[model samples]
Target: LAKTTQPISMDSYEGQEVNITCSHNNIATNDYITWYQQFPSQGPRFIIQGYKTKVTNEVASLFIPADRKSSTLSLPRVSLSDTAVYYCLVGDLNRDDKIIFGKGTRLHILP
Candidate 1:
């Protein structure tokens, strides 16, 4: 698994768009980028994933650059209830790889 670099914290008001970027400069060809969100005292939940280009789900959109070294998770119209920690991870999911959770970016959504 490749270590990811992300902002420590971010803030946005309700109804604003929030984009969190993660850098995986040493990502391998088989690596995939995944994002997760966790609320206080709750387990983390999967948000989105992508190998290259864009991937969108019901909750968010993931955009990976052609270089496959970085990705951005886009959250639209975030509300106060959307406040949580967001994690960006990279690894070869095809293999028996263990996904390690790190200190993710804390997103604060203001009213």
Candidate 2:
């Protein structure tokens, strides 16, 4: 299964679009890729998820390759409030599992 990798940090001005990509080379068959956003001192909140192809919601768009080795989270018309840390979690839902957190990609939005 592919492990996940993401940028340590990113910066954007208000009203700009931000796209964060995560690479997972050995993702398992039963694993699902989920994206989350977090502010300082807070837990990550679910942003989006996908098994394959593309999935979009009011908050963001997720694009996954056919091989499922990587995924991207695209935030459009970003505002200062969008500045935060973004995380890509890869794991299976079945069985009792523990989710771990790493230093996520920090998105800084300039006012």
Candidate 3:
């Protein structure tokens, strides 16, 4: 598993776009960059994932650079309800590896 680094917290106003970046200096070729969002007492919800370049879903977009050392999760027009802890994970999903989650970035959507 590739260790990831993210901000401890972030703040954004309603209707504004938020981009949370994650750094994985030792990413492997088979590793995939995955983002998750978790509210209080709830399990982390999948946001997006990408191997390289860019990938987008209805909820958010994921951007991975050429080196694959870093990735960004972009949320468009956030609301107060969007506040949550966002996690960035890098690993091979195909394998049965234990998922180790670090302290994720806490996003605060302000009014």
Each candidate structure's TM-score, on Cα atoms with residue i matched to residue i, is 0.94, 0.92, 0.96
How good is model 3 by TM-score? Answer: 0.96
Separately for all candidates shown, the number of backbone clashes (residues 3 or more apart, or on different chains) is 0, 4, 0
| lDDT value, residue 94 of candidate 2 | 82
Model 1, TM vs. native: 0.94
Give lDDT tens digits, candidate 3, residues 36-104: 999999988998988999999999999999999999999999999999999999988688666668799
For model 1 the local lDDT of residue 27 reads 87
- Candidate 3 residue spans exceeding 4 A from truth: none
46, model 3: CA deviation in Å? 0.7
Q: Go through the candidates in order and give each one's C-alpha lDDT.
A: 0.90, 0.88, 0.93
Best by TM-score: 3
Report the C-alpha lDDT of model 1 over 1-111, residue by residue, as the tens digit: 688899999999999999999989988888888899999899989899899999988889999989988899999999999899999998886787887666899999988
RMSD of each: 1.1, 1.4, 0.9
For candidate 1, give the lDDT: 0.90
Off by over 4 Å in 2: none
